[model samples]
Target: MVGLQSTEHAGDNCTPLSDERGSYTTAENGFKEKDATDTHEYDVYGDEDTAEIKYRTMVWWKAAALMLAETVSLGILSIPSAFSSLGMVAGCILVIGLGALATATGYVIGSFKLRYPHVHNMADAGEILAGPIGREVLGAAQVIFIVFLCGSHVLTGLIAFDTITEGASCSVVWAVVTAVVCFICTIPRTLNGISYMSVVSFISILAAIFITMITVGVNGHTGTVTASAHLTFAKGFLAVTDIIFAYAGHVAFFTFIAEMKKPEDFPKTLYTLQICDTTLYLIVGIVVYAFVGDTAVAPALGNTGQLVRKIAYGIALPTIIIAGVVNGHVCAKLVFVRIFRRNGMKSKHMNSHTFTGWATWIAICLAIWALAFVIAEVIPFFNDLLGVISAVFASWFTYGISGIFWLHLTPRSERWTTTKQKAKTIFWSLVVMMGALIMVAGLYASIVSIIDGYKSGGFPGPFSCVSRAL
Candidate 1:
């Protein structure tokens, strides 16, 4: 497989490649634009032997599918509870406003990549900003966030199964089933392969949500709701965190952008996710809350009538399993690629099928999924867990990290030569502060909520066979 090569051409604007980091040189200006072909950072991401075949092969649409599957998780259904906590007024504001912010920050990450094309993951990006310590910290955080996401998927799949079956079997049984299926689905060697399953995953979610909207409209039963309301600080922040979870795909953005056929097309795919997810979140949150009011469950399908819920959960089956599959694949792929790339055991030059490479990859996938399954069985409050996830991971991955990236790539910190530069600096500083607020406050609220759950016995024990739907 031939990797792309964009060498410098003879032009007056040429900037010679030197010891500099994060230079934005374009092909038209005769500066050598970094490609995955020969960079050490690229090799650290994946060895050159198998790089062309495994990475940098996805089109924008397939990339969107993988991203959509990752970003738009069970969190979409949690938005209505947010509406109930803060009413529709603040709820919509948080959803749309934070969503726009998430989008803008996402663009910052893309810009960082376009400028420094060698970054393959958050660790690499972090190293650019704060050296080796940053790499270790961000790399661990990336794995944690992805692993937690996989666990959330496992938990949600259990809920879907339990809702459909009405607790006919042990809850642990359903969870294990979900884990096994997710593990099997994650065995595909590439995101391009996973992208195929992502199409079905998207359709599954769409069908389930529509079923919910239609059935709720036809056979309506509702409690009182309001467009204006107030919430305690902890409660409001929790709701905001849920909205943040809806756009928590940034952690994987570098990975996704690295694989795209043309990384510039990333925003198109990002917009695809933003439009579809935010719109669905708004519609489903409003419609479900209008029908179920204060008692609306996070995955709103459970808020429907008995038969309607079973049908909706049945339709949602693909998404329940496939979304988790997508996340598990990402988590496993990151670990597998990082290890194999370092060892130079790619299939191109080595027999990856023997005990050395393929077996190790499969083992890594299984280990991550198994850990996710354990997470599903523990703690057990869906909304609370999501709040913790958003606060701890998304705050940095989606918001603060990009702000740092922007500042690093911009003019020197102390002196801005122009008004626009100063303004940009001010704007990013706010972005960073806002992220800090979410991260700190979000953690506090989530922990308090969890404590409250334990006090009220609202939480379940780990590996409980009892149904979690109640």
Candidate 2:
């Protein structure tokens, strides 16, 4: 395989590569190269000559498919509800604007990774910007972000089971069953292993939502479909946050790029994710909201007739579970890498598929899934959980951090030297501010909504056996 080479243009804009630890550099390609004696440590495929497992093997399309599966997961379920709150004009604008912003930020992430080829996750990128403390802070944040996503999936699974079964079983029992199934599905150790499953995930969600759109369109709507709504501040912002969550997949881009066969092909992968998701979000959100109008519920699957609702949720089962599996793999890999790297045995054990490697990976997956189950039982409400996760984590990881990355990549001296460069500088500056505004305002809205839900008995208490089925 040809190594990833930075285009002359990409190289010109980037600062000369240097490493504090002197263990890696960008001279070999777009990736880092270890010393001669430690050559295998940073080999793109992790000592492929002897190792039983290889990670950097996915082609661009496969990586794009995995990202589509990971990103376009449960988030899509919330878009139509957002439309109901924000109305058609504001909802469509936010969806398109945010999707475009997510694409730009995602591109920034790809550039940052190419410049510092060793950076595999947010934590690594953090290290370059702020040192060990940055590493710890961003690393913890990334894990928390992915974990919340896992929890969201678990919550969706619970809802799916309840919706499908008509509440025949205790909700808690369904939550446990959901977690166990996610645990088993996440046992695959490599992105390459899981990429095939993502195809099924993508197809499953497409079929489920299309069925819903067709059914709802034919049956007609519950209330007026407006271009605008006169909602309160908290209500409106909460709706906007749901749209933000729909494009929150930027958090996983670095990890995806790391595992790609040709990291330089990431532009194709990024565009693939953005286009598919944006088009899908617009169609699904508009169609569902137009049909259900003001009475639309989240996860949107429940808005259909009883039989169709069950069928939609049933068809959506693979995406609900497999998408979670994709994220579960990320968190598990983060922990797995941190452990082995700390002990100076990463390449040997992680790449060789040793007993220690397999044991540690499985244990980590089990532990993370168990935590996800707890979070699902505690939160129990789908929209509120997504709102909080979007506010707290997605705000920074997806938007704010990427802006910082772009600013960091350009040489300060050159930032104002050209018209195009100046425009980029100004745009990225706004992106940073937008992320902060979303975080602060979004947190307030999400909190208020949750409080209101509890006060009005709209939300069941944590771990209550109440069914969240619509």
Candidate 3:
């Protein structure tokens, strides 16, 4: 059996507990102790054995690749559909711009917290800046939002499955298959394998985009560049909200930063990821809009595969299907980890058992899919409502949190210290307040859309119109 030792060198401030004594010992008996200059050793796993905890830094490119994989998934497929429903020209510009601004703001806030590296995660940073209440609020909000986002991904996967396997099998069966595949791909013991999977997903998605562009180019199609008579500013902004909702994974990027070896590298990685994501979204949006046109884009490709298959038959469909599965897996694992930790379960330990852990994950995935299926069948306009809610939260998380962090972190004396800093503070604060007001308006608009959908006898046309108007 091997033993481990911890040496307390100069400047070490940790206090020794009563259980830590003068000699090396097995943990099953009690924790060992060490003096200022002596090394203390312990048995690994309460046995007379020792093991090393290995740590490695992530390369900049790996971080960028992970972020790229996450950004491209369902967001790319949803953007063009949103543009068609909301009005292409207006939706594309506003949504893409606002989403980028919000994301960049979040990166700034994260960078500010990283200046004091002792804080481990966003929740810890919130606590340092604002106290216990801030920690609880931020932690609870993050966990809940992650869960909802995971549920949203499950719903998206089911929708994709239904689209691909239309008329051949039941939607529920397809949903189960997709969920199981996602669970297997996720819930692993380590994050090392995800990089390769992410690369594959990225490649597959790019191929689909290539097919889409070729199809549009060969057809000599150039999409409508202006809004129609029916399109108004109100509809334009609402459509913008929808497009932002599809790209609202900015906050989630912080989770990766927390685990990164060099937290300071996050800003560069985040900026690069967002730039890549925006470029991809713009190119895909142009191609999809050109190929299908506004009149056909809205209702024709209800699923991602339908759109891909329409452009290219052999490879595009399967490529998109695999990409959807990868996205669903990543989202599920993220949500599960957050929820489990919030409930006081050690996710690392729980996730080690493949059978039990995966079974629990599968159950959660099914429940989310079931709820989505019911909403899709009964409400039909549920997607629009989801889009609005997601946008509201995304806006609050980006603008509100960024403003709060900046306000709280700056010293009171520095409030009026510099003209540029003062201007920045005011600008951020106003952005936060405006985001809050917009969220309120979005909620009201969502309610109105739902009512209109009910009155229209299950038709989502009125909701789409209202969504565009907002």
Per-model CA lDDT versus the true structure = 0.75, 0.82, 0.52
Candidate 3: which stretches are off by over 4 Å?
1-57, 85-92, 116-130, 222-224, 227-234, 290-293, 296-380, 459-470
**Deviation (Å) of 247 in candidate 2:** 0.5
Clash pairs (backbone) in predicted model 1: none
Model 2: lDDT to the true structure:
0.82
Off by over 4 Å in 1: 1-53, 343-355, 380-383, 413-415
Identify the leading candidate in terms of TM-score.
2
Clashes per candidate (backbone, < 3 Å): 0, 0, 4
lDDT of 3: 0.52
Q: TM per model?
A: 0.88, 0.90, 0.71
Give a tens-digit lDDT track for model 1, residues 349-427.
1213345566787899999989988887876675587678779889989898878887776646432655766777788
> Which one is best on lDDT?
2
Candidate 3: residue 184 lDDT (0-100)? 53
User: Candidate 2, residues 56-138: lDDT per residue as tens digits?
Assistant: 88999999989999988887888888899999999899999999989989988988886666677888778778877888899
